[model samples]
Structures are given as structure tokens and as C-alpha cells.
Target: MNKEFDDNGAAEFEKLLQGVKPLAQDKLHFRPPVKSRKQIIENSHRQTAEVVFSDIYQPLLPSEGPMRWNREDVDPVEVKRLRRGDYVPEYLLDLHGMRQTEAKREISALIQACVRQNSPCCCIMHGHGTGILKQQLPIWLAQHPDVKAFHKANKEWGGDAALLVLVDVAEPTQKR
Candidate 1:
């Protein structure tokens, strides 16, 4: 009777192990983390925050000359250098068919990029289209705190259709 019981148990165990296949290991695949994509989205959202180009204080810009401006603390020679094409732009943003809203967001992102990359200068190309962007771009650049100075581009840098902007990328020195 003991021999018969052992034989029955062994047969049952063998039946349970039928048709089990081993896992395949032929190819390697890489999947980037979903968190990486989420971070990218979050970063873009932060950069696209509403940058209010205030109308309460539009400085009377000359209609017939090269547009230029700078923060009160900035040196005038910075603007002169920009005019002479002494400072080459590290990045260039071209606004051709973009509407006002898109253009504004792009400008904001561009400034953020410049600040992040420690880029000292950038150029904005607002072509002579309907004159909408051309008129509004200087005001926007002037209002941005990061914009230390800007001037109409030199002939080699798109001339009257573009503006060279100086970004304040220097880390503030802490005092003891």
C-alpha cells in the first residue's frame, strides 16, 4: 500500500509540470522613464507662464530710428557694442508667422533659456511684416528684467529687422 501511494503522488507531480516554456532572451530594449517625459512637460509649463507685457508705461519709441533700450543700472556702452555687432548672439529667435500669443511665449522661453545657459546675448528677428511684432518686441524686451540691454542689429546681424539683446547672466556676488 505504501509503494502504491508513492507512485500516485509522483505521477500527479509530473502531470503538473507539463507544457511550461522558458522565457526568451534574444533582444535588448531600452525604455526611458515616464517620469522624464513628465518632467519635460512640467518644465515647459513653467516657462510658458503668463509674462505680462504691461501697457501702463510704454516709453515713446522713435518711429523712424533703430529701437534700443537698457535698464538704468546697465552701461550705455553695452547698447553701443550691440549696435556695432561686437557681441555675437548665442541664440536667435525668429518670429515670422507666429501670432502675438505664441511669439510672447517663445520670447519668454528664449530669455529663460539664455539665463539657464549663462548666455550673454541673443537676437530676436521680428521681420518687417505687418509691423505688429516689430512694434511690440522692443516693449516686451524692455520690460523683461533679464534683458540688460538691446539695440537694433547691425547690417551683418539682420540690420533694422532684428534686435540684439544682452542677458544678465552673471551670478550675484554674496557679501559677508
Candidate 2:
């Protein structure tokens, strides 16, 4: 009877094994925690295969430069007229030591606030970095949609290290 019982158990185990199917290759594959790993691997593999990078990847940057404006972009000699301290900045935000991302967001908020408050002009003291502001700030400023016009501040203001931005004032009727 014991032998017969063992034989039946072996038969049942064999049947269970027969019913199990292996997982699909796609399901069995593990994903790495790093997102860029896949891209990096593909890039490397293509390079080893003698495939040109252009075939697998597109350029990330545009060939064109930022918009350009001459003195004529604004009324002639109006900038000199602003020297009488007529351009009062209601809000002055100094991003002297903020991190790159923080500075960018703060600048955006400041521009919006200036507009909301109907402030005609504002001063941003980005300071003279060895070149940090020179590189990052300009990119942020150019990408900023709300910025009407900005230029290097006059020497009396802060010279090349700072910017004098003319903000669009909210219409009086719209200011609630």
C-alpha cells in the first residue's frame, strides 16, 4: 500500500510540472533603477556595431540663437531718461547665493510678482560670479516668457554683474 501511495504522489507531481509554463522572456527581464541605463546601453551597443549616432539619436539643441535687439528695440534715449531714479522697483530680489534651480524659480516668481503689482521696473542683483551667473542666469532670463526686455545695469546700478529688467505692468483695471 505504501509503494502504491508513493507511485500516485509521483504521478500527481509530474502532472503539476507539466501544467506549469515558463515565464516569457519579456516578463523575466529585470529593469534597472537608473532610467538612463537603457539609453546609455543602446548608445554603446550602436557604437560597437559601427552605427552612426545620428541614425539612433537626434540633436537635442536648436541651431538658432536667442532673439536679438538693438537700441531701437526700445524708445531711443528713454534709457538715459530713466537715470533720474524714475524707474522705481517696488520689489528688489537678490539671488546672491541661491542654487541654480532655486534661483531660476525665484526669478520667475519675481517677474510675475512685478507684473501683478504693476511694477514698471525691477533690479535683480545676480552678483559677479567667476561666471556662474554669466552662464546660468542669462539662459534662465532668455527662457523666461514674461521678461519684456532686460539689459546690463548701468555702472551706477551694478554694471555687468546685474540686470535692469523692464516688466510689463498689469493694466489698472485688471489689478484687483
Candidate 3:
């Protein structure tokens, strides 16, 4: 390789570059920084009312009766169908013997996997013992971005002891 460039070569390069101009900037163009997952979740929590299990649960409700919820965007007919157990769940998660923390983690994973797989419906069998899981399940489901709606399973499907969740195939943008 050549040890060095000739001085004339350097001067020629500089002269050729001097005529070139830098790219123009658009002063009005602006974009905010993308939020991290934790930040997005924290923001979502702040925007929605916190789910308190005690406030939401009704232990006295009969096991044979149906309990249901639907987002504003969900159709009324769809909720009716869910209440009737018309739609079969494609995924099932049984949190029978699991602790609260473990159940929570499992539910989150299950819902995410369902969404990724584009499965629209899932069932969770969380027995009606002290009604702890039954009570807390709604709160967790409500917080989940992918969950569009949820209803208590029908008599044949575990009744009050289980939940049939309707998951959105697409990523959820706004809070429910």
C-alpha cells in the first residue's frame, strides 16, 4: 500500500467536497421517544381505575348463574353469546392448586400466547374455594391489554369456578 497520499491529492479532495452541501433539515418534524414496556404499563395503570378484588367480587352469587364483562367496543350480542357459552375456548389454563403469584404469571403468559397465536377465546379454571382466585381473576383480566371481555363459565364448563376470556387477535391500543 502507498505510505501516504500526495499533498495535491488531499487538496483536490477538499476542493471537490467544498462544493457539496449538507442535507436539509425539517425544523417542524418531530417525534417523541418510544415508551418502554414498563413505562407503558405504568401509564396504563394510571389511566384506569385500579382493580380491587374485594370491591368487584360477589361470593354470594350462585355457581350456576353467569357473570360477564365486555369492553365498550365489544358487541352486546357477543357478550350474550359468551354468557351462553356459545364460543368454545381454544386455550385452557387450570390454576387449581397454584398460589396467587403463580396463577397471575400463568394467566399473563396464557393470554399473551393466545394473542400471539390469534386465538380469540380461552378458558381459565380457577376453582371456587375461598373465591380468592375467582375474585382476583377479573382484576388481572381487566388489566391485561389483550383481553377484550370475560364471562363466568356456564354450568357444564365449571360455572363460577371458571372464566371464559375473549382475547383480541390484534394488539390493544387503548385501555379498556
**Highest-scoring model, lDDT:** 1
**Residue 116 in model 1: lDDT:** 81
TM-score of 3: 0.59
Relative to the true structure, candidate 1 reaches a TM of 0.69
Query: What is candidate 3's lDDT per residue for 52-171, written digit by digit as tens?
Result: 212444333234546677777888677778887788998889999898766766777687678777788999999988888887787677666677888888877788799999988874
**Global CA lDDT computed for model 3:** 0.75
lDDT of 1 by residue, 1-176 (tens): 99999999899977987777778986856877557887886567455535455535586565776798888899888888888778899999999899877788888888888988888899999999899998889888878888899999887778888999999886645212
In candidate 2, stretches whose alpha carbon ends up further than 4 angstroms from where it belongs are: 1-86, 174-176
Where does model 3 exceed 4 Å of error?
A: 1-65, 171-176
Give the count of colliding residue pairs in each prediction: 0, 0, 0
User: Can you list the residue pairs that collide in candidate 2?
Assistant: none
Model 3 residue 52 CA deviation (Å) reads 14
TM per candidate comes to 0.69, 0.51, 0.59
Model 1's number of clashes is 0
lDDT over C-alpha atoms for residue 19 of model 3? 75
Per-residue lDDT tens digits for candidate 2, residues 83-151, read 444566667778888876556556766776787778877877788766676455555554444555555
Cα error of candidate 2 at position 77, Å = 6.2
